[model samples]
Target chain A: MITTAHQKIGTPSITTLSETIDNETSRSRIPGNTGIWVGIFCVLVEFLMLFSVYFIARIHNPEAFLNSPDKLLTIAGTTITLFLLSSGYCMVKAINAIRSDQSKTAFRWVNLAIILGFAYPIVKYFELSWYAQHGINVKGGIFFGTYYYLTLNHLVHVTWGLMGLIFVSYRTVKGGYTSESYSGLEAAALYWHTTDILWIVLFTFFYILR
Target chain B: MIGSAEKTWFILMGLTILGAVVGEAGNVGWPLTLSVVALIYIKSSIVIDHYMEMRSANQRIRNVLRLFIILVPMLVILSFAWGEEIRRFTTLS
Candidate 1:
């Protein structure tokens, strides 16, 4: 194991050391941090609740839902999906690199992830701008309202993931995490992956399942 | 050689493109809608098993996450097929 700063403290008593080892071992059983999973679980539930609303709206106004996607920019949605997926792949690479104690490689991978993550909002900006130019605001109808609500809600989550990625990338470069001590980096990666999966669902709802 | 993550990413990319192509139509029928749902389910499973590494996790957490992903797409398919009746049942009016 690489001697990271977290492990550089004065040698502790056998009890604490054994407990720490056990803790790390237990942590691997689930992967990532517990708090992140809690947050992810909540986010998943929230999205399901939103989809329930989608189901309701589609039930009553199936016509509106059917007519809406054609007016929107499929290119924008596709681009954003690409960005999110590419970024998620980079994150996975970062986690793998860090697990092997390759800090510099991990740093590059995470930085790449950050770049791709930021690409999402830039595309979203132009897409929303196009909507504005075309008079497709939230008040257009039930479909537009739901579209704006859910997409923006997803944007908020992406923003959060981007922030986490930035922080993790910074720390990862400085060797803040190693094979056995990467809870923070892993947590951020997990969170970003969660956001990616949610956005995939959102993309399917808004752009795919006309 | 490509690792699991890269392989997963490639599959997601292909599926996303496929979904985009499917969505380009003006009005999709139940067949396409269910097809998209299947894509969503497969993509979700890949993320859970590969990216999140949840297969080796505890039984309960794994089940909950898997169940949520499975259930939502199922609901979407159901609503797609039986929209009118479901609407009548859920609404107050």
Candidate 2:
């Protein structure tokens, strides 16, 4: 074993430098945390089963699938889609800002996300009321059954995400997170993004696919 | 360069509008359905890769998330394309 010059000089050797670089590069960089990913995975699995039901129902009654969108209010679907997307964008900005050590900006961005997120249920309420007035209840048919179930399930997820945002936003305003420690904000953002993606798929299925 | 978040948001919003326009155009066919499905795939991918920052994630996590996103649109397109065959196949079981 030859003694390297750096070793003789009491400095780090080339092997040490390379090992440090490798360790840094190979480290698993999880966004949010492991717990949030597990939650996201469960949400995806739940939606996957729901989507299977939708496909099977549509396969059995293609006409109902084709004609279903004609009776629903496309405007409500579009509005909710826009709201979720905007909220998702704000949450992403919040995470980005926090990562840059701009906690105040992050707080403002998260607040925007929460505000936009709250608009979702409000819009859904009016949309449902409109559906009721137009006799588009669950009793309408199988198509309506699938529609109500899927949309309501998504709405429930959105509400949970909103609650998460509120808590995260409060912590953010209280200076609970910083660039070095912001996993909670990132977790909340991940949840909101997941919810946004779900709504996009739902919008495509219920409003655009027909 | 525009921020990634803003860029992705614009792309998502544009795709949403484009999907609506295509849906409302009364163009009924596999082409239209496939186009809509393709749009959904792209939107989901953008959200995963950019918004969720999965682009730099480990391959295992990225692929798992991608597979989940791709499944629904694939099933939807397949069902749309082969509804009669699927219905018959299911009924025979």
Candidate 3:
């Protein structure tokens, strides 16, 4: 009689566990979380509108667009690009480490990302100072106007991402994530990567185009 | 084996360097414009696929991002190719 009851309970438990695993694997389609996706979509739409303005301006004044990169420092742009990409790579490593239950390694990666991420604003500060000294401000011309507005907008987004990283790193240190549950970390990573994508586009527009 | 993220990063870095060289090589023209546009498309796709992990995401999500990634660069190229016509049309009295 005891064996019969044990069998009944064990069978249902196994079945339910399998069903849960199946659901989880199937639902992994959404990266990070739905909330972050919504936010990212909004950000993308905003940038799309901004990009339209950039294209329109470029069409109306091709010469300005052509000459803009000559005035700007390509080294500044390249350095910032490398910093953002490295930071993004670090964030990915952190996520992979956490997914594999390597919490300490994940923590170290997150710290590295933060360190590299913070360097962006620092570089931008000097870049801006150099621009000012060289008379590259909004009043300089159409090109400078568009460049300042677009790049400043992107810098604001990167600032927000950096703040998110700080919070996520703190949460990570407090044992808030594990292999089974790291959605917060993933959400932070998605946001950072989105910023990285935006910067890449901006780099091409303001620095690389000639 | 190299991880996907590391590999993508290296590719992006390489392309970035190539873009700089192309931009600095000579006068601004169709070839430079087209190359930069292509580089933008490829870099964005890499970030979308590997960094954002959208490669395995749902079809709708993937399509939306891919469309965005393609559309912007296409428009930029179009503007570059036909900027004079667009400027004239917009400035019509």
The candidate scoring highest on TM-score is: 2
Task: Provide the TM-score for each candidate, comma-separated.
Answer: 0.89, 0.90, 0.89
Which candidate achieves the best DockQ against the true structure? Answer: 2
Question: What residue runs in model 3 are displaced by over 4 Å at the alpha carbon?
Answer: A1-28
lDDT of 1 at A154: 92
What does candidate 3 score on TM? 0.89
Give me the TM-scores of chain B across the candidates: 0.88, 0.87, 0.86
Query: What is the C-alpha DockQ of each candidate?
Result: 0.52, 0.58, 0.51
Span of ten consecutive residues with least summed lDDT in model 3 chain B: B19-28
Instruction: Residues B1-93, candidate 3: write the lDDT tens digits.
Output: 887777888998898888777767755778777887798889889988888777666667778888887888888788877878888877858
Model 2: residues with Cα > 4 Å off, grouped in runs: A1-27
The CA lDDT at A189 in model 1 is: 89
Model 1 segments beyond 4 Å from truth? A1-28
All models, RMSD in angstroms: 8.5, 4.2, 6.0
Question: By TM-score, is 1 or 2 better?
Answer: 2
Docking class of 3: medium
**lDDT of each residue in B9-88, candidate 2, tens digit only:** 88888888888888777667787888878988899999898888887766567788899878877897788778788888
User: Can you list the residue pairs that collide in candidate 1?
Assistant: none
lDDT of 1 by residue, B25-67 (tens): 6557877778888988888888877887777555567788789
lDDT tens digits, residues A79-193, model 2?
A: 8888899998998889888889898999999999999998899999999999899888998988999999999999989888999999999999899999899999999999999
